[model samples]
Target chain A: MATSRGGAIGPALVLHLAVLAIVVVSEIIGLIRVPIGIGAVILLPILYAFALGIIFNPNVLKATGRVLNHDATKLAGTMITIAIMPFIARFGTTVGPQIEKIIAAGPALILQELGNLGTILIAFPVAVFLLRMGREAIGASYSIDREPNLALIADKYGLNSPEGAGAMGVYATGTLIGTFVFALMPPLVHGLGIFDVRALAMSCGVGSGSMLAACTGGLVAAVPDQKDLILALAAASNILTYATGLYAGLFLALPLTEWLYRTCAPADRASTMH
Target chain B: MNNEIAISDAPAEGRAIDLASHAVQLLVVCAVALVGNWVATNVSPLEALPGMACLYAMTIVGLVIAKYMPFYLPSVAWISLVAIIATIPGVPGAAFVNEAVGKLNFLAMATPALAYAGLALTKNEFAIARKSGWKIVIVAICVMFGTYIGSVVIADLVLRITG
Candidate 1:
């Protein structure tokens, strides 16, 4: 059933077409245009997908399970993987011409963007002390924003490890809400007028490229004069997140999380910990 | 020998037909994407075509490179790198490429991809989180919370230095 024969399409093909139709419908309904089209907006493509998926879910495991189990979805996941860079690349070109301006503004803006790592500091303690989550969950909950984090965790703790499940949970959560939440930060900060627009713009690049773009887009619309430099700083910071985030998270962030889990986890429960 | 060989070739012949159909299916998906873009932005389909072409073409090229890479370079990085090089200001077609591709919304493409992901999700997908109980949700919230706090602190510090 997974494969097609005699020039006929299969379930996978139907699934793809059905999904695309939903996308077209969502666009027509303007679900993506919520909260104004300015700085840090919520596009909600993932939300849309989840909603439609549940609605269309046949509830029959065999037929519906086919969509979940096929090799085609894996291929589609590959398609989405390739989609990330070009998505960022589009933003990259927009900022490429403005690199010199951002450089002249101040290199310190790059450091400001490192705040993305702050998640580990806070998430680890909260997960270990407040929530009493296991060590694996601590690493996962800290930074499950990207693919490499999943790989790193899985490599150290087998895919079936508690850490893997924890990673998957957080990854799903991040995929669902991380972009929207992160997208709102710049404008909110800008509205507070607590920081210079440049710092706010630079901070927008907390490593997730799309989130960076969304944050920067909001800032650009909010303060149009700073567009080029803001975008440039964000692009630079985001690229750095991809380049350095893996090692930083694995070496620096997760270790801190692990240490917190060890220190904060109660003595009775600590002995059982990984 | 001829009848036996013909019988053996049926599945292979069917596979070839399936492959061709699969390609058509991809093309149809692309068409839906373009049409959807036009409806959402009111950008003419003609204007959006070039950008869509570049996006898919580069993805194909990126896939090819990914197939050969010795290490684990993501396909997006490769596609993005090529797109960036192509659109640099001094390049011959930079302006055209930027304008054309810029017209197509990457978010639009993401819609279908996410929707497909949704269809694949059954209630069972949440079983792990359920077993983990409320702790997973707490971790998710804490992750976002910490990231926000971190962003604010970093932004504040950077502003202080620059100002």
Candidate 2:
């Protein structure tokens, strides 16, 4: 199956087969726990599945990778949108029977979206003066640079420009590594004992479904009793993020980061380049 | 008339395969998901079949609705709406839909979902990620951290005042 040279099996089927095999292995491994000094970190099957995927990619091992083909990656991106439907429905279905519970989360659901803007507040300056990046920092720092933002940036800057390059750069990196950071973040923050588990769970909605899943999975592992509420709030929070991330990134985040870039990049460049 | 305004990045070759083939592919995924739910969550595949089928049906029907709708609302939203209304309190069979879907762990579904996503992470994309160097990489981490932390803080405050 690995070395078969394009007899008849389509790349999409091959990709699904790879997912099926990985899912079996990953689920058997199940969730793992590691005791770091601060706390025990829970690693979900999804994390293992993600790692196995990276290794399975043609880049690491030519044998399995050859079956993936060039079109497979593009196909993977499209399928991702479809693949998460049940996942969405999984939590989305929770909304009705649990409507009262979700309703109680209403205000926090709306307010937490403002927190997404914190992406630029923290990343813009770091990308500019500290990192000595150019205006590309604008696109990179404004929002989490997921699909909607990618379209927003591409619409404004056309993906061929520096700003667009910055956006795509972060978008790609997020796809590669964001799941790990998101998965691990909940436990670390939970360890801090500052944020409520429900709040931490709600905040896990970072726009991308995989990132949201990894984050919510970490929290569910951390606080299993609260799993139902966590899933409800995370799903609702994600929907709000999807509906608003574009508008907020366009009207608020993009413009703000553009100004920040203008104020800092020129001075930072002059001193550093000199 | 509406197809030409396509926003989807679906393979142009698969253009003809959109609605029908998509449902078939989803069925295959639902099967894999059924197995994962069995292995990981101990939810019997026998027990999970109805809920799995329900989610599958809701998704394909939702996609069809999204395709035909006059305006452009996200299919995720439509799918979620379909699932919600179908299971909402007092609707016929709502109880069955609720109990059935609730059996299959959402996180179990997430493993395969992310796995599908992970399959797309190409070596070329990884190389291109390095083209901009580590600055954007670090910045990306900060951005993710910032949004997550920021949301937690705000949510913590609101939930506290309200809880």
Q: Which candidate number has the best TM-score?
A: 2
What proportion of the real contacts between chains A and B does each prediction keep?
A: 0.43, 0.72
Candidate 2 per-residue C-alpha lDDT over A14-68 given as tens digits, one digit per residue, 9 for 90 to 100: 8878888989899999989886866568888889988888778766678876788
True lDDT of residue B113, candidate 1: 47
How would you encode candidate 1's per-residue C-alpha lDDT over A82-171 as one tens digit per residue?
334445555555554665665665556556546766777777766766766665556566574456676676567754666666776676
Q: What is the lDDT of residue A254 in candidate 2?
A: 86
What's the i-RMS for candidate 2 in angstroms?
3.7
**Residue B98 lDDT in candidate 1:** 74
Q: Candidate 1 clashing pairs?
A: A39-A218, A40-A218
What's the lDDT of the predicted structure labeled candidate 1? 0.58
* Most lDDT-accurate candidate: 2
lDDT of predicted model 2: 0.79
Error of 2 at A65 (Å): 3.7
The CA lDDT at A25 in model 1 is: 75
Which runs in model 1 stand beyond 4 Å of their true positions? A1-8, A31-46, A57-79, A82-86, A102-109, A183-190, A196-235, A270-274, B1-30, B64-71, B122-124, B148-152, B159-163
List, residue by residue over B36-85, the lDDT tens digit for candidate 1.
67867888778888887776665555545644666645444555556656
RMSD of each: 8.4, 4.6
